[model samples]
Target: MRRIAVLLPLLAIGVLAGCGGSSSSTAKPVVKVSGAFGQPPTIKIPAEKAGGSLTVKTLIHGTGPVLQRTDAFVGNYAIYIWSGTSHRLAQSSFTAHRPTLFAGQLLPGLETALIGQKMGSRVLAVIPPKDGFGTSGNPQAGVKPTDTLVFVVDMMKDFKANASATGTAESNGGKGLPTVTAVNGAAPTIKMPTSKPPATLVTRTLIKGSGPAVTKGQMVVAQYVGAIWSTGKVFDASWNRHQPFNFTIGATPTQVIAGWDKGLLGQTVGSRVMLVVPPADGYGKSGSPQAGIKGTDTLVFVVDVLGAFST
Candidate 1:
């Protein structure tokens, strides 16, 4: 068995709070596996006669309350790549505490597994190629497209509605612009007027792309550029790097500040947006060490929509 380093320290501990529940001595039987790529998993449970095959597996069991769509969750999990003869390409662990069913937070298979699970439940899910990293595979993940992925997940706490109630009226503070138009069952389109320059020079559309419409839980990929609205000075941009930063949207309140969330919500694929964020919305009080963004700086971004995934 090839053992990759399991970086547990990188895992989010706070997310695993309610996962340490009592374990049931009785073991659930693992029977024949039936299913093809691009299809849901199937497991036969002997405990209940009416039990149908489970699309995913709950390896570690928890004894906490069940979860609902309105609830949010925090968790720690390990992902491993599985070869035919028990060899694993790589493994890593991380923490995620966010609205469980929200789009753009998790992989397709893991998101599907989490939908009906409750707090304190431990899940061990076997993900096939199509459901995991697709054809190109995750080179950094060390798993090939042909590899099967296994995830051991521990659901910590499920916070009920209004759990982390931000007193503000909108989800984030009422900072972001209101929806100008809604994309109704069509590919998102941006109509930038050629004749006139946008009212603001610095603008961005943080998330973009087409797959499934982004909700709140799944991960989002985007391209971004930052500049000053006044002088058009380019401050920061991901265009040169040619790689989008991968962050699970809404998973960590601290990963991104309030302004970003407010800016991104309800944005559809292929949307282009401009933001003129005040110092309070950009960098408040303390500027970033590396970026040289000042405490009093009002930032602007030009964001391009790339793609979204919901599993």
Candidate 2:
């Protein structure tokens, strides 16, 4: 969960956004499912069918805001491969996770299931092969391209965009860890450290925010640039991606390295902070070659805290 993750086909709608939703309307249901969201639902998989269109059925109605096509959404969802070994459960976000989903980031069939649905609503959707992974299946999740993907999505919250952090320029040399520099409101850059790595996590606030305080379990949205202390070369950066990434500070699953969980906790949103992580708090002795990191290497990061939300 540290780097950009490869989501299973059913959970891989992370690129952009799209539109569509399950409604109480003229569309007919081809598959029937029982039970509810929050608890595993009983699904009666439909007989194999040729390529077709998408369908939807609402098991629980909600009274929250109607999800719009352009809005960003976060929620818990479950996916089952239809017409396979007795409705195989493929993926789920119901356990210790909160995924950030937005328009254009969703598959066509999934877009339809999300729109028009209100927060707290649970939806059952049937996606034909054309609307799903198509002919080339997701081998990681065992979709064979011909597989039909079924989803039971739990609409959660629509996160409002957070204003980026703002502050005056300060001398970069006073910090005990790494020196940080920022352009005219651009992402901050880290000047690598020449000193031996700290034995524990080190946190220093370069800029402060007035927004809400970040708690331990709340999902944190931040833009960050990470580099190896030994070389001071960048390995990963959300700034380069032009988007912020988030993690549960100290949560069990999908939580980031220990340095982040400890460094950013209690910091207010819209703040800018730096983390100097020892090997123990970072990628550990094995290190991450993918990031050009070594076992004994330390890690440095300049993180811009953007937003925090609980899904």
Candidate 3:
């Protein structure tokens, strides 16, 4: 067993009692695991389950860097629900098509379970409704409001953001798309596109990098600033938060705009690129007003590709 320098709240308090009025001592080893890492485990559930809090048990220990709560830790997971009798495997992220999940991206309970665990570690956890799909369980996954969820997760890698946006600074003519300028390693400021938005995608690599080129189906860790082409109003920026934003490019149930898929497909990591996305490739007819974009607004983005992970 490897030593864990950082421990989550669950590890310290152990199993909590709740759900029904029964005490947790009645549900020892709420989630039973009898399988090797990287493969589906034989999970067994107790007749009595926990509900008040989360129960996490480390199955395989890892002797690597301890992960932070907000780190974009790439992982694979399989989730199941305790259906009255047996544990029915619901969803599995253990395939080659697993996505890297972050804080605001996963269930609050799962985050608590993964935090403090080092990279390459595997753990099993039982989550109650309070920390899971609340009173109204996710009907899509056949999860009942009162169902207890179990997960087998494998923390794979810890990704780090790049420092300065490095790459070959190129020009896109004097008045074509948009103009981007950065100083002293600061975030690039854009002078929004003056001409009408192009019908096709307009991608310009402001900086050419020496790192690996981003490929389709790879998750990109990056810092970016987005704006509306109509008014040049900055919609969102990752640099302002001093944190990097990440998403799978060209992935199933795409997490980012189509502009990113087309613009960043062949770009190199560590390079800053600008994308001019028309309505067809953006939020489309139903624009994101919360993002300050109109139905017909053309979106612009200055993305700093920090890293790419696949597997």
Number of the top TM-score candidate: 3
Error of 3 at 165 (Å): 5.2
Better of 1 and 2 by lDDT: 2
Q: Which is superior by lDDT, 1 or 3? A: 3
* 1-311 per-residue lDDT for model 3 (tens digits): 00112222222112222223211222354566787766656677676644455778788998878987555656667777875555666666555465444423456566667778987788887777766666766665577787777888877766543245666666632377778877735677888656787877788877777889888888777888888888888878876765577677776667677778878898898788888888888878888877777879888888888778774
Taking the candidates one at a time, how many backbone clashes does each contain?
A: 27, 12, 4
Q: Estimate each model's TM-score.
A: 0.40, 0.66, 0.69
Q: How many residue-pair clashes does candidate 3 contain? A: 4
lDDT of 2 by residue, 140-222 (tens): 66767666677777776554333246543334534457788776446667776567767778787777877888997887777
Which ranges in model 1 have alpha carbons more than 4 Å from their true place?
Answer: 1-34, 38-213
Comparing candidate 1 with candidate 2, which one achieves the higher TM-score?
2
lDDT per residue for candidate 1 within 1-311, as digits (tens), equals: 00122223223111221111121122233323343322232433233221111237665456777766444454545555555545432333332322121222345555566767866676666555555555655655465556655556667655443221111121111133322222322222222222323333233443343433456755445455565433445566644443343344554434454455566656665445556666666666785536666665555554444444442
